[model samples]
Every structure is written in C-alpha cells, then in structure tokens.
Target: MTVGSTPPKTLYQALFNKRMLICICTGFSSGLPLYLLIQFIPAWLRSFDVDLSTIGLINLVLFPYTWKFIWSPLVDRFVPPFLGRRRGWMLITQLGLLLAIASLALYDPTTNLTKIIWTVAIIAFLSATQDIVIDAARREILPDDELGAGNGFYAQAYRIASFVPGSLGLILVGFYPWSVAHLSIAAFMLVGIVTTLLMSESSKPSEVPHTLKSAVIDPFKEFFDRDGWQSAVWILLFIIFYKLGDSMATALETPFFLDMGFSTVEVGTVAKISKTIGATVGTILGGVVMIKLGINKSLWIFGVFQIVSILGYVALSIVGYNYLMLAVASGFEYFGVGLGSVALIAFMAKSTSRLFTATQFALLSSLAAVPRTFISAGTGYIIEAVGYTQFFLICFACAIPGMLMLFKIAPWNSQKTAVEETIAE
Candidate 1:
C-alpha cells in the first residue's frame, strides 16, 4: 500500500482521546530507563570519584540505545500470546528495564564496575527495544491529521523523562549517598512498569506492511525515493551534532557547578526544578505552536532557538554564580531543547513508512542521540585540559559544521517539496 493522508483531527479529539493519552504515557515510558543507563549514571559514578574517562567508557553500554534499528524488525514482525503485538513487546521490555535498573541499584560502580556496566547494558538494550514499539505505535495510531498534535503530547511526556530522570536523579544523588541514589534510580523505573501495564496498544495499524519484504524493503526504498543519500547525510549529521556544543557543555555541568562553588544541593535544586519547569512548559508550547504555525515553519524557528540555547552555557561561563543568569540560562536552554527536540522528532515520525516505522524511527531517533554520545565520549578529556570557558567555546564551534552542511544533508528544497506534496495529497 502507498502512503496516504487523512484530514487533521479536531483539537478536542486530539487532546481527549484515550488512545492518544495512552500513546503519550507510553512515550514517556520509553525514555525513563534511558537516563539511568546514560545520563544520570555518569554523574552518580563521578560522585564516587570515578575517573572521567571511566564514566565516558561506561557510556558505551548505551550503543544499543543508539543502534537498535538493526533489530526493531523482530519486535514488529513477532507477537506474544495473551497480549497483542506491540503491547506484548512493551510489557516484556518494560519488565526487563525494571529488572536491569533494580539490579543496577544493587551494584557498586566503584567496586563492581563490570557488573554495573553489564546490568546497565541490558537496561539500555531493553529500553531501546521498548522505544521501537512505542514510537511506531505513536506514529501509526494517530490519524494523519493528528500526527503533529499526537507528537506534541508524546513530546510533553518524553521530555518529562528527560527532565525528571536526569535532573531529579542528580538531586537524589546529592541528597543521599551512592547506595541510596541507586535505589532511588530503581524506584524511578517503576514509572515505566506502571505505564506499560496500564496503557493499551492502539488498534492494529491498517497500514502496517503485512509481509517480510514490504516491511523490510519498502521503507528504505521510499526513504531514498523521497531524499537521496545527501538528505540522509544532512539528517544524520544533524542527529549527530545539532546539540554537540550544548551537550558537551551539558556533560560538564555537575563539575562546573561544583567548581564554581555551588553546593550539590544548589545545583540539584536549580537544575532539577528549573529544567522540569522549563521543559514542561516548552514542550506544551512547542506542540501548540507547531499546530498553529505549521510543522515546516516551526522547524526552522525551533532549530534557530536550539542553536541559540547554547548561548545559555556561554552565558553561564561569562557570568558565574549569578542566580538570575543561572535561572534564565538554565530555563531557556532546557525549554528551547524541549521545544526544538519535539519538532525534530515529529518531523522524523512523519517520514516513516508504515512497514518501516520502527526501523526508520530507530535510525532517526538513534541519530538524535549521536550528539550526546559524541559529547559524552570525550567529555572527560575536554574537561580535564580546557577550563569550562574555553571548552564551551570549542563546543559551540561544533554547531558550525552541522548547520553549514544543512543544505547538503536535508536541503530546504526537499523539506519544501515534501510539505507541498503532503498538502496536495
């Protein structure tokens, strides 16, 4: 079957539907364990005085999170008994996430690095698999008219994970010692457990490709048909570095705050509360604006704001210990990230073919995390040699290569044609 478009759903329906709410909740679930496996884990380890490179190396456990597209097909094509396809996979993977994270709480990163890494690797893998199912369901279940709104709702939930897990986890680590923080991290995974058990999958997708080859071959064929290797290159580059500067700056946040004479309590309180508040507001605002202004226009606007948010870090470096600067910069950056990220995600969600939803979304979304991976990988070395000021400047420069290459990678021309075609269809 070919791609088809339906008229947009009403505002009321988009906001209130049971399936839509479930889709949004599960989207949050998909990201919950990821913080433990990637973001918060490093900070926790760092608290124990674990070497920075070790923290960076532990990040490799998350390769699965960034590469799960290779195996999303198995989940899409297979099913479990009692529960339907997506639901069953979601249930099983959520259980795995719960177990892995709980076990992580039990291991001592200093004394048991190997065991800790193994458990985290398992959790990251399961989390990525859950992403495959949940992302496909969110994209497919919504009517064509509602993809943007649905994406908005889903964005709200997903960024909540981004905020709550990382920022709050830091606070948890600050308030308690390492052992207690691990347990708190485990308890946080319960959010996913509750969400998966409570939420039902959407109706079996009418457009889901029925056979192996269609699901296997059609998505790639259609993707290339729409935009060639150059478009793919642009998207891939953006995914890998759109936020490289910000992310590089982000990786050193806890250290920088500590160096600047802020107490753990201060960093935890400001980063946690500010990020949660900003991202929540930013997500809802982004979604609403996407609907009103239209997705295509919103992308450019949101993207510029994303780039600008890096200035917040630059702001922090320039004005140290000023709470006002801290608050504005923290809030604005988190908000911009939340708003911009949803636009990027919704755009990716729209591009997937039914047969290849999981694979394509996995590829694009995985690419989304590539920036974090690159930043996390070398954050240790950067922080060690260069002070925060110079490091942030270097990080800021990484944006240039990607932004300059945007035309070659995802040219405005293709985005324009794609929008026009959608409107015509």
Candidate 2:
C-alpha cells in the first residue's frame, strides 16, 4: 500500500493478530514508569525540601530520551536470539527497566538523591530504547490507513500508563504511608516484567548484516549519501519545537497544583478521569481529522492548535486552580497534543524510504521529545528565570519553528517525488 492512500487490509486482521496485541500490551507496560520518574518523582522530592533549581538540574537524567537516536541504529541493525529484530530488543530493555525501577524503590530519595537519580536515569534510558524498538515494530506491522488509529491505541496505552502511576500512585501516597506507596509501585514493575517475558516477540530474528560495516556503517552512509539528510534535518527542528508550549505548562503543573492547595485526590481525579478522557477523545478526533483532511493540512491545523493551547496555562496562572478551569485548559492542551502527535507520526512514517524504515523511524520518533526533554530538563531553572507565566509564553513562542519548517517541507510533505526531493539548490 502507498503511504498516503488507504491500505486494502482490514482492521480486524491487524487487531485479531497476536503480534499486534503483544505490541500494544508491551508498549503500555514499558510506558508506565516514565512520568513516575520524570514529573512525579521530582515533585515528591520537593516536599523533602529538594531545591527547585536542583530538581531542574537533576532532570538532566532524562537526556537519554533525546539522545536515544544515537543508538537507534544499533537496535535497527542488531538482534538477539529467541526474539527477532524489534521484539528481542524490546525484552532486553523492558527487563532492564524492571531492575532499574526496583532499584529506585529500594533507595529512598529523601535519604539518597544520588542513588535515586542514577536508578531513575537507568530506567529512563532503557524505556526510551524500548520505545524506539516498539515503534519500529508498529510501523512495519500496521496497515497505512490504520496507522492513525494505531497511534490512537498507542496513546491510549501511554495515557493509561501515565494515569496509573501518576494519578493512582499519587492518590495512594497522599493517603497511605510511604512504605505502602513504594511497595505498591514496585509490585507493578514486577508485573510488567512478567508480562514482557510471557509475550511473544513481534518480528522474527532475521539476518541483516553480520558486520559493523554492513549493519551500522552502511546504513548511515546511505542515509546521508543519498541526500536524504536535508529533509531529516528539517524534521529534527520541527520535532524539537512542536511541544514547547504544552511542555512548559506541564513542567510546572505539579508545583502549580500544590501551590493552589489541590489535594492529591484532585490531581488524581484529573489524571484518571478528565485527563485520560481528554487524551482518548482527542486521539479519536485526531485520527478522524487526519483521515479526512490528509497529513499535510492536518499538520497545519494541529500544529497551530498546539501552540495556541499554551495560552491556557497563562490563564491558569491568572485564574488560580478551579477544577472546571483546570479541566478545560488541560483538555485543550492534551487534546491538541494528541492530535498533533498523530500528524507528526504519520508524516514521519511517510518520510521514510521502505528499505530503511526501522532506522529512519527510530531517528524521527526519538526526536519527538527533544523539545520536551530539552526544555523540561531545565524546567525548574526556566521557572526560576522568568517564573511560570513567562515560561508558558516563551514556550508558546518556541512553537514558531514547527510552522517555519513545515512550510519549507511543504513541497516534500505535498509530493514525495524524486523530482521534488532533488530540486537544484
């Protein structure tokens, strides 16, 4: 099937298949711990008198999410026994995360931030690596028109992960003793490891190239040598700037909520119900919009919406923490995110040459969080520098690059012809 057109395959064929189900389950399992360490953990630490500046600086541990592309080529080119291409690497990384999370549970951050940071970093790194592998598997397996719907499912699972750990866990932490909360989260990690082990590998191990020269060396040369590098560069910038607005708002959410005197239950209520519902509704809406409008125009609409929603955070800083106000703004931002994300993923999928699908997709998708990860690492510092309102505004401003780059790529996004790709410079 062509990248732009609907695939002839049926949705039932993809859904009933065991492989896709495993991909969905494993993807969600691997996804759960992310916000636990990045957003929630930092906020928890602050209650112990952890400095905001320190929290901001310590977020550098998340650098792996941004840099995972460096090793994506390794995953694309190598495979282990028992599992093939994507699945083998998936198991390895997921197992590694299980160990990392357990290690963090054993080390109390109040007592030892040093050890906790290292363990969190380890989990984040492995998780990012696992995402690259799983994404490659989905792109290879799913039908074209179904890609939008598949992304919807992926977001659903990811939002659940975010919800369970962030919302449910937070609710427990507020009511129960620390021991209970830590033990509960650790138990969840154990279940995740078992689920990963029991699932079948998505793709079978096949011989690609035996040597470093063939596997790692040749793909890079061809990707750059063929002059595909220019489009890839533009893509990187778009990804880097796409989520700046929402991210800036999000970076301060926990603190903002706390400052406003909302209990953990209130935050959890949003996570489990409102935020989760918004994400789900937004994803469905995004998939339909993409299908109706097509990738190019949807890119414009969604990208613009993404930036505009940053204004909601500014409103929150002004209006204070009313539940209704929070719900409406969160809905706008997260929903916008869900929509824009579908467009970006589909667009990136269209950009790949089929032969290099695994490597190229990894590179593109990992860049998805570059802006979020980059700005967020310094989130505390930025919060300190300009304070919350200005930070949101700055993030809103950062989104301009998405349009600028998209316009430059308009030719490429519009027509994927050799003639278009090779215009005289």
Candidate 3:
C-alpha cells in the first residue's frame, strides 16, 4: 500500500490488535515510575512541609531523564541473559523501579531529605532507562502506517497510568501510613513484569550495532547524514521546545493545587479526575484525527490547542479556589497536552531508523525532556517572583517558538516522505 492511500483496517481493528495491546502494557509500565516521581513524591514532600523552592529543586533529580541518551548505547548493544534485548532491558529496569519506589517508604521527608532525594533520583534513572527500551520496542513492532494510532494508544495508557501515583496514591496516603502507600504503589510494577514475560520480542534489525562504539556513534552519524546538519539541528530544537510551555506550566502541578488552597482530596478527586478524562478523550480523539489528517497537520492543529490550554491555568490563577474552575482548567490543559503529546511521539517514532531504534529514540526523547528537568527546576523561583498568572503567560509564550519552527521542520502541507520511503522498502 502507498502512503497516500487509506489504511485497509478500520479504527476498531487497528486498535484491537495485539500490537496496540502491547503498546498499552508498555506504556503503562513506562509511565508509572515517572509519575510517581513528578506527582506522588512532590505531594509527599509538600505534606511534610517542604518549601516550594526545595520541592522545585527536587526536580533536578530528574536530570537522568534528560541524560538517558548517554547510556542508551549500552542498552542497544548488550542483551541481558534472560529476555531478548528489548524485553531484557525492560525487565531489568522494571525490577529496579519496583525496588526503588518501595525504598521511598524507608525515609521521612523531613528528617531524611537527603535519602529521599537519592532514592527518587534512582527511580528517575530506572524510569528513564525503562522508557528507552519501551520506546524502541514499540517503534519496532509498529509499522509506519500504525504509528499514529499506536502511539495514541501508548500515550493514552501513559496518561491512565498517572492515576495510580498521581491520584490514587494521594488518596491512599490519607488512609494509610506513607510507607504502606508507597509499598502499595510499588506493587503495580508487577503489571510491567507480567507484560514483559508474556510479550514476544520485537523483530530485530537485520544488521545490529556490532560494538558499543558503533551503537553510540552510528545513530548520531546516520541522523545527521540523513537530514544534513542544518535540518537535523532544527529537528532537535523542535524536540526540545515543542512541549516546553505545557511542561513548565505543570512542573509543580501538585504543589500548584495545594498553594491554591485545594486539599489533597480535592486535587486527587476533582482535578485529577477531570484531567484524566480530558487527556483520555483527547488522546483517543487525536489518534483518530491523525488517521485522517496525517501527523504534520495534526501537529499544527494540536499545537494551537496546546498553546491555548495554558490560558486555563492563567484563568484558574485569576479565579482562585473554585472547584468548577479547577476542573475546567485542569481538564482543558491536559486535553491539549494529550493532543500535542500524541503527535510529537508519533513524530519521534517516525524519525528513527529501525536499526538504531533504541539509541535514536532515546536521543530525541531525552532532548524533549530537557525542559521538564532543567527549566522546570526554576519554576518555583519564577512562581515566587512573578506569581501564577504571569508565570503561566510566560509558559504560553515559551510554546510559540516551537510552533514557528514547525514551519521549517513540519510544515502543514509537507509530504510524509519518511514513511513513504519505509513503505517502498
């Protein structure tokens, strides 16, 4: 089939396939520990009276996410003794995450702040490593045509996984000791373990990267050689800035709700529920829309939605303390996040060579994560300096450069040359 022609499968058939189911499992596994770091841990710190600046500084621990590309070559080059390359790494990291998450219960944030930070850092490292394997595996299994719906389902499952540490963990802490809550959340890693055991390894590339040096050097060499240095630089910049605005806006999300005088229950039940519903509907809708519109147009349209959604946070800042407004704002913002993230992920997956899937996707995604880790660390300072209303406006402004770059890298009328080439092959 040509790239210009409609896919033979219906949406239902596309979504119900084994590949999509695997996407769901891998997505859930990939998302859980990260949310536990970004959502649950921050809330835990705040509850123990950790100041905003300190809590914000904790985002620095997530530096591993931004740097995971450095070690991705190891994952790409070496297979563990048990499962094949991808699933082997997945099993190892998932197991490490389970242990690291549960270890968070061993310290009190007040007295053992150093210990907590180190443990959270370890979780972030494991989570980042796990994401490398999962992204490569998903890319290998999904064909070019299926990238949109496949990544949509993956992104959906990713957002759904947030409900565990983001929403349910918050509520659980209300009834149980922090230790019990931490352990309970840790148990969820079993889902990934089971999925890893049952799922077949994705088809390997015909030619593997024979040495660690080749794994490290060749992905970069191929990407630059393929696009030329100038276009490749533009693509990397877009990867960094595309989601910058929304990412900064939500950097201290749990803390933002608390600062706005919402109780943990209110944040957990109302705000999270609304956000999850909006994200779920938006991702599913975005996936379907991509099937019709193609990824380039979807990026243009969804980029607008993402930019506009930051205004909801500004509105909440203006109104203050109203549950209806909170729900509306949170839901709207994440709905846009869902739309933008789905397209971006599909774009990243499309950008990689299957032979260098793990290393290339890791480099692309790690660049994508730079804002969330480095720039977001300053958000607490920004919030204190400018207050919520202006901070969000700045965030809204941060998104504009990325949209403009789309003109260069992902122009609205551009052909899907990469996917067409893959189809020809």
Candidate 4:
C-alpha cells in the first residue's frame, strides 16, 4: 500500500485489531518509567525535604532520553538469545527497569542521595532503551496506512500510563511507606513483560546491519541519502521546532499554577482530570480524523490547534486564578499536544526504512526531544524576564517557524507516494 493511501477498514475494525492492542502495551510500558522519573521521583524527593536545587539537578539524569540514538545501533545490531531482536531488547530493558525501580525503595533520599541519583539514572537509561526497541517494533508491525491510528493509540496509552506514577504512586505514598509505593509501581512492569512475552517479534528486515559501525553509520547515511541533504535537514528542523513552543510553555506548569494561587490539591485534581480527558479524546479523535484527512493535512490542521493552545495559556496568564479557565486551558493544551504528537509520530514512523527502523526512529525522536530536554530549560529565565503572558506570546511565535516549514516538509497536498518512491530506490 502507498504511504498516503488509507486502508478501507471501518473505524471499529481499525481500532479493534491486535496491532492496536500492541500499541497500547508499547505505550504504557514506554511511558511508565519515564513518568516515574519526571513525576513520582521529584515528589518523592521533596517529601523527604531534599533541596530544590538537588531535585532540579536530578532532571539532568534524563539526558539518556535525548542521546538514546547514540546507542540505538547497538540494539539494532545485537539480538538477544531469545525473543528475536526487537522483542528481546524490549524484554531486557523492561526487566532492567523493573529491578531498578524497585531498588529505589531501598535508599532514603536524605541519607543515600548519590545512590538514589545513580539508580534513577539507570532507570532512565533502561527506559530510553526500551523506547528504541518498542518504537522500531511498532513501526515494523503496523501497516503504512495504520501509522496514524497506531500512533494515536500509543499516544493515548502513553498519557494514561502517566497516571500510574503521577497520581496512583503519589496516593500510595500517603497511605503506605515509600517502599511499598515504590514496589507497587515497580510491579507494574510485569504488564510490559507479559506483553513482551505474548507478542511475537515484528517482521525482520531483509538486511540487518552486520556490524556495529554499519549499524550506527548506515542509518544516518540512508536517511540523508533518501531525499538528499536538503530535505533531510528540513525534516530534522521540523521535528525539533514542531512542538518547541508547547513544550516551553508548560515547562513549569505546576509552579505556574501555584503562582496563580491554586492550591496543590486543586492543581493536581484539575490537571489530572483535564489532561486525561483532553489528551485521551484528542488522540482517539485525531486517529479517526487521520483516516480521512491523511497525515499531511492533519499536521496542518493540528498545527493550528497547537498554536491556539498556547494562546489559551496566554489568556490564562491574563485572566489569572480562575478555576474554570484553568481547567479549560489545561484541557485544551493537552488536547492540542495529543493531536500534534500523534500526527508527528506517524510522520516519523513513515519516514524510516524498515532495515534501519531502530536507529532512524531513535534519531528522529531524539531530535523531537531536544526542545523538551534542552530548550525548555530556558523557559524559566524567559518567564522571569518577560512574565507568563509575554512568555506565552513568545512561545506562540516560536511555533510559527515550524508551521511555515511544513509548506516544504509536509505540504498540505503532498502525497506519501513520493516518500515511498524515495525509499524504494
């Protein structure tokens, strides 16, 4: 099937398939550890009276996520003794994450800060590695036409998994010892391991990279050679800039809420509700819409929603401390994020060669993470300098460059047949 062409499956048929089931598992497994690091851990540290600076520095451990592509070739080149290549790595990384997360229960942040940091770092590494194999596996298993819906399901499940660590884990900590909460969360890795065991390995590439050097070098070479350097550069730049504004706008969302005089309970309750409902609805709806609109058009339309969502924050900044507005703005922002993320992921999946799936997807996704990991770090300074209203305006402006680049990278009328033709060469 051509990349741009939709399959004739009904919405029910599209969503009910085994492939979408796997997408759900892939997303939940991939999201859990990352959220554990970003959401649960910070709260854990603060509960123990760890200094804000130390807690902030802990974010640096997530550098593994942005550099996972560097080691992705290792995953691509080496198959484990069992479960074939993709499933083998998925199982290994999930197991490692399980053990590492449970190990956090053994150390007190007050007394064993260094050990805790190192353990979290190891978890981050394992989580990032898991993402590489899972992404490649998803790409291999889904048909070209299913990329939009498949990734939409994945995005929804990813957001749902955040609730485990972000909400459930925190609630557990209140009623139980930190150890129990840690172990409870760790036990959730069993879901991933079970999914790995149940899933057959995705179809193997016709030509697997024979050596580490080839694995590392050839994926980059293949991507650049596919459409020449100019197109490749445009795609990379779009990946970086597409979500840059939204990411920066929400960099310190909890602080922003607090600054607006919302209590912790109000912020947590409202955000969890809004994010769950909004992101869930957005992804599922986006998936169904992409069936008709195609990824190219979805990008253009959803890109507009992304820009408008930032303006919602801008409105909130001006209105200040209104609960209804907070809920509306937060929900709308997550909805936009969901739509944009699903479309972007489908585009990235479509861009990769199956032979280089792991490495290429890793590189593309790492570039997407750059805005969140690095550029968002400066948001605090920007907000301090210009205030929230102005900062959001700047974020709104940052989103436009990416949308403009879409005219070249993913034009509204462009057909994926051209991309398929390039890969066929």
Error (Å) of candidate 4 at residue 15 is: 3.1
Which digits, one per residue and each the tens of the lDDT, describe model 4 over residues 246-281?
877765665676668775456657766887788888
> What lDDT tens digits, residue by residue, belong to model 3 across residues 1-425?
88799758876876789999999988998889988988889899999999888988899999989999899998888888887888888999999999999988899988999999999899999999999889888888887777777777788888999999988888888788889889989999999999999999884644457787798998889877775687678778898999999999999988888889998888889999999999998888888898799878989999999999999999999998999999999999999999999888888877787667788889999999998999899999899999999999999999999999888767678766343343345
Full-model lDDT for every candidate: 0.69, 0.68, 0.88, 0.82
**TM-scores for candidates 1 onward, in order:** 0.87, 0.88, 0.94, 0.87
Which whole-number lDDT from 0 to 100 does residue 5 have in model 2?
A: 97
Question: Evaluated with lDDT, which candidate comes out highest?
Answer: 3
Question: Candidate 2 lDDT, tens digit per residue, 161-186?
Answer: 77766677778878885545655665
Q: How many backbone overlaps does candidate 2 show?
A: 1
Model 1 local distance difference test score: 0.69
lDDT of 1 by residue, 1-425 (tens): 34696556576866788766776677678767865555577666766778777776666677876787777766766677847777788888887776677666677766888888888778878888888888877766777777766777776777677655566666766667656656666666666667667766663756445777766666666666665666555556666765565666676566566556665566667765776688788788888787666656666677677677777877787788877777777787778777777777766766566556777888778877766665577877776787667877777687666555545434554544252354245
Model 1: which residue pairs collide? 8-145, 234-409
Which pairs of residues collide in model 2?
84-205
Q: CA shift at 365, candidate 2, in angstroms? A: 2.2
Instruction: Arrange candidates, best lDDT first.
Output: 3, 4, 1, 2
Model 1: ten consecutive residues of lowest lDDT: 415-424
Higher-lDDT candidate of 1 and 2: 1
Q: List the residue pairs that clash in candidate 4.
A: none
